[model samples]
Target chain A: MTETASLRRAARRYRLEFGGAMAAYALTVLGTSLWIDANPGSSARLPVALLPVIPVVLVVVAAVRFFRSQDELLRRRQVEALAFAFVGTALAVITYGFFETVGFPRLSAWWTWGTMAILWCVGTFVSSRRYG
Target chain B: MKNLLRVLRTERGWSQLDLAEQLGVSRQTVNALETERYDPSLPLAMRIARLFERPVESLFFLDEDAT
Candidate 1:
């Protein structure tokens, strides 16, 4: 198959796998939350809370597979974007941590992941423009 | 690095997309190569040379200042 066809197939597969994994994560989170709420102080609460991580692992696997499928230029772009996101997220979190020490409201650790994800998109866009 | 990619590609009457298709890369990559915004990997450079029926040295060269 042509590179274009192979790329399209990889993209489609990634979308399907990522979408399915996210759906599963959402369902697991909802189920676990409800179960915990209904049975306060249950021994299984810790395990149930961690259940969502399984689907998240699958999502990460799907992402890695998609990255591997891309050509050299695209792989370089992805590496640059990921580097940008990694560094940007670190700086942001550290800055935010300093603010929290100086009377700002404390934030959840989940915000770090959210910030990284947003920066990843921004980095990808910036890298795309750089190449174009 | 400087390359005669644009000149060679136009000489063959191939659009960026057509060349990208032939090279098995995205059109943006082809555009980057033509504009000298990106340098291709050695393998990609070899592939381009093979496709154009030219030696790699004939297709690409260092800028005079770099020599």
Candidate 2:
């Protein structure tokens, strides 16, 4: 198969894996939250609360596989984007940490990941435009 | 870096996507190469040279060399 065909196949596989993982994550989160609320004194509360992490791990694996499937140029772009996201998210979170001490609301740890994801998208867009 | 990518590509009437397909890269990567926005890695440069049947040095050079 041509590179384009191979890339398309990889992309299709990635989409499916990512979609499935995200769906599982959502369901696990919903289920676990409901279970915890219904069984506040349950002995398995900690384990049930962490159930969503399994799908999250799968999502990370899917991402790694997708990254490996990319060509060198795309890989470079991804690296650059990830670096941007890493630094941007770190700075934002650290800055917000100081604000919390001054009276800001405490944010969930998930916000850090969400911020990084948004920054990654922004970085990818900027990098794409730079190359174009 | 300066390169003869655009000239050679146009000479053969190949679109960016066509060359990208030949080079196993995205069309945007081809555009980046042609526009001198991004430099290819050594292996990729060699691949391009092999594809065009040209010496690597002949295909790409420092910008100062153009002057």
* Models, CA RMSD each: 2.4, 2.0
**For candidate 1, lDDT tens digit of each residue in B1-67?**
8999999999999888889889988777888899988999999999999999999999888889346
Question: What TM-score goes with each of the models?
Answer: 0.91, 0.93
**Candidate lDDT (C-alpha), each:** 0.91, 0.92
Q: Which stretches of candidate 1 lie over 4 Å from their true place?
A: A1-3, B65-67
Question: Clashing residue pairs in candidate 1, if any?
Answer: none
Per-prediction interface RMSD in Å: 3.4, 3.2
Error of 2 at A99 (Å): 1.7
Structure candidate 2, residue pairs in collision: none
Off by over 4 Å in 2: A1-3
lDDT of 1 by residue, A1-132 (tens): 333656778899999999999999999999999999998978988998999999999999999999998888899999999999999999999999899898999999999999999999999999999987
Q: What is the interface RMSD of candidate 1, in Å?
A: 3.4
